[model samples]
Target: MYEFVTGPLAWIAFGIFIIGMTVKVISVIRLASKKDKVVFNHWSWGWSFRSVYRWLIPFGSRSMREKPVLTIVFFVFHVCLLAVPIFLLGHNILWDERWGITWWSFSETSADYLTLLLMAAAIVLILRRIVLPEVRIVTTAYDYLLLAIAVAPFVTGYFAYHQWFDYKTVLIIHILCGEIMLIAIPFTKLSHMILFFFTRAHIGSEMGERRGAKTW
Candidate 1:
């Protein structure tokens, strides 16, 4: 009976995930095709690529003078948060056992540390948005809600890992939060994720045009 329940639910979740991702990707591609071509200046493209490279390296220099502490905290949080689940041994074990995919894992200690860092980052980001006038003025209610939605799964999963509450309940909450975020991804400002590159290129192109440069 338990197997029957979990089996069908798993299939349903898998179907939703696959279909939703396909739709979102197709929409983004269509939108991009319809939009004006965005050109980038040599320096702007160089900086964008450099930022990605810096993110991969342990500590590459990048200026964050405008919001130094907040920028550092945000980057640290994203790095640790992303690294944890993808590299964790327990997650790999589940994948291998359930789906026959084998992958490497990081240490449990590292996962725990990353989880703590991610939670701290979420809190700090929320506080920064509230306390800083510039951040607050620009933030919509949806922005705050989206942040909460994005962070809830990680936070719940951390507690679930520690068995801080009933294991089943916490696990269910974690999964539900993840599913909610998945559903919300293509509909909200979270969609900026799909549009970010184009938006950056468009801005860069406009700036170059203003400066009377042939390149964006």
Candidate 2:
């Protein structure tokens, strides 16, 4: 079971993630080209890049500044979300062993703190969805499920690292949850992970080039 999860199952998860995201990106671009050809008419790379950059930075946009707390938490959660997993010592070691690939890694202590921070942020996001009337109106069970999917790996990983339960079982659950997240990203609203750039670029170009207005 351990061997299969780490070997073939890992490959399958990565394969689906890559292929699914590629397909989605290509399809969206092609669809846009056909349906919204006007978008490209006045597309400005400058505005697009500026928009993406501004949105990437915390409190860079007016809307973000308006909600300072959420902006900080959102940025911290996402930064740690991407950072902790890829730079985790254990994950890097696994990649080194499996594919002869490795990168700079965080100390175990640093990873622990980042993981805890991520979990806390996830909780805050979940609560925000429930507590904020406007946000709650748009929230759905699927949204909560997606949040759970995003955070489950970290939760299980923390337990696995601490060996708080049966180490092997916790480790297995962690790997599985991580893989599930990878597989889900390109298919779900989590796709905002990739699509945010493209959509932001379109909006930025339209608003900036076409209307002489700032998007951010």
Best by TM-score: 2
For model 2, residues 17-48, the per-residue Cα lDDT tens digits are: 99999999999999989998998998999999
Q: Report the C-alpha lDDT of model 1 over 75-183, residue by residue, as the tens digit.
A: 7776775677678786688668677886778788778888888889988988888999988999888888988877887888788889997888787777677666656
Runs off by more than 4 Å, candidate 1? 1-22, 35-63, 204-216
TM-score of each: 0.74, 0.98
Worst 10 residues of 2 by lDDT: 207-216
Q: Residue 214 deviation, candidate 2, in Å?
A: 0.9
Clashes of each: 2, 0
- The reply for model 2, stretches above 4 Å from the true place, is none
Error of 2 at 22 (Å): 0.6
Best of the candidates, lDDT: 2
